[model samples]
Target: MHVPDGFINAPVSAAAGLAAAGAVAVSLRGARRELDDRTAPLAGLVAAFIFAVQMLNFPVAAGTSGHLLGGALAAILVGPHTGVLCISVVLLMQGVLFADGGLTALGVNITVMGAVTVLVAYGLFRGLVKVLPRSRRSVTVASFVASLVSVPAAAAAFTAIYAIGGTTDVPLSKVLTAMVGVHVLIGIGEAVITTATVGAVIAVRPDLVYGARGLAAPLKLRVGGELVDATPAPAPVEPVAARSTKKVWITGLATALVLAGFVSFYASASPDGLEKVAADQGIDKKAEEHAAADSPLADYGVSGLTDARLSGGLAGTIGVGGTVLVGTGVFWAVRRRRAGAPAPAERETV
Candidate 1:
């Protein structure tokens, strides 16, 4: 959920900002351990994909809609640390460029939509993967469940935050009930998107999917009339060409572009779960206008563009491009840090 300005008092918002900053700092370190040549670039694409998919909001209730939060999907595809960064990137882009989320509420959005969702979804996903059969289908199933739960978990997080810093006098119980109830329906949409995306990636390149790694059952042998674990054979050395991620990367980027640039036009126009709840629960009574409302790309449309399709489509494309660029740069830097090498500029000087 994109929390707008003035919804939370300054003190609580500042606290959340500190918490979100701490989480981002921790994730940057953790991501160094997770990012590699194969995953670093893909992580950027994942952020772009999340941004693209989020534009296609699906109807949840009569007047409410929902979109992919991307926490579970990213965690399943990359890793939790990287997933948090991905959602944070998307949120930042939306806030600063699209004016979709408020500048002052950036921390609240990141805490609820980025940190909380990734922690809950990834933690639950790992637990389910351990108990379930180690199969691709099981990974998809786990993803579905994890994503479904993450939405409500984020909703609850927002409710708790509001309870502490809400600007209005709405009843906590009413706000919680409404937020959780509406988001439960929204969670279904999140689950479907996560499951399909995870399943598709697992089918094509399971190695690229962090959650699906090591899913293949180990070999077994019969010894002395008892089945025993077989010694693992040395993995075959794959050719450089065979290990290339260019194809998948290109395909994924293309898919994201298509989704944001075109398919988003058909998405439901209904207010999303958070917006609906805020309006109904009086959470927006003191909501302030986005600081970036005057930006050319505000409201997901280009300035002075008459054609809705052209304006929105262009904005979406620009957003995808910008997210991929920024995300890739961040992840690549983390990968370099993990390798214990200086950045390109430093290396050049050395």
Candidate 2:
């Protein structure tokens, strides 16, 4: 959920900001280890896709709606550290350009939506993968479950944050119940999207999916009375596999454009889980105005554009474009950093 300004007080907001900063610092380093030539470029596309799908909020309960969170999907497709970075990039773009989330709540959003979800989902996905059969189906299953749990987990985290710094005087139990209940419904939507996306990727390029790598269980042959490992010949990369990567990227970008530019018009207009909880608990009574409320593209709509479609369309396009550019640049830099090249100054003037 994109927490707007005023939900939390100054001290709690500052604390969340610091926590987000720390998480990004850690993600930068961790991503250096995860991203590479093959996946680094793809990570940006993933971020863009996340940005697109997030615009398409699906109806959850009767009046509530939810959108893809992207933490589990990213971690399953890419690596956890890089997943965090991907989501962080999208959140950053959405915050500054679209004014989707509060400037002060930037840290809060990233920490809860990016860092915490990635860590928990990735851990759960890996653990399940280890126990389940080593197949693409298993990977998809694990991703689904991980995503399902991560939503409620994020809701719980927000409750904890609210308990610490909620400006309004609401009972913690009420807040927790409302947050968890609505988010649980939202979690179903998240799980479906995550599973489908991960399944599609795994089907095309299991090797490219970080979580699916090394998923083929080693074969065993019965010898005498005991089971012995059978060292099968290494499988060669197939011709379809070579083109799969490019196809997936093109398809992903195309899908992103479709969702953000057109399909987003159909998204539910009802308040999401967070907004509902805030209103019900009276936690938003003292909610402050956003610092960047006057931005040209605030609220995911252009200021001067009279037509709602045109304004939101342009903003959505800009968001997708910015997410791809910034995310790609960050991931490419992380890849370079991991490669351990020295600064140009260290090479001496030529």
Best by TM-score: 1
Q: What is the C-alpha lDDT of each candidate?
A: 0.93, 0.87
For each candidate in turn, the TM-score is 0.96, 0.93
For model 1, how does the per-residue alpha-carbon lDDT over 1-350 read when each residue is reduced to its tens digit?
A: 78999999999999999999999999999998788998999999999999999999999899999998888888889999999999999999999999998888899999999999999999999999999988888999999999999999999999999999999999999999999999989999999999999888888899999998888988889999999989998999999899999999999999999999999989999999999999998899999999999999999999999999999999999999999999999999999878996678997997
**Model 2 lDDT at residue 68:** 85
Q: What is the lDDT of residue 312 in candidate 1?
A: 90
What is the TM-score (0 to 1) of candidate 2?
Answer: 0.93
Q: Pick the candidate with the highest lDDT.
A: 1
Error of 2 at 343 (Å): 15
lDDT by residue (1-350, candidate 2, tens digit) is: 99988888889999999998888898888888788777888999999999999998888887788888899889888899889889999888888877688889888899889988898899999999999998888888899899999999999998999889888888999899989898889999999999988888777777789999888877999999889999899878677546546777788888888888778877889888898778778988987777777889888888999998888888888778888889989899889887885567966864
- Clash pairs, model 2 backbone: 6-288
Go through the candidates in order and give the C-alpha RMSD of each one to the true structure: 3.2, 3.4
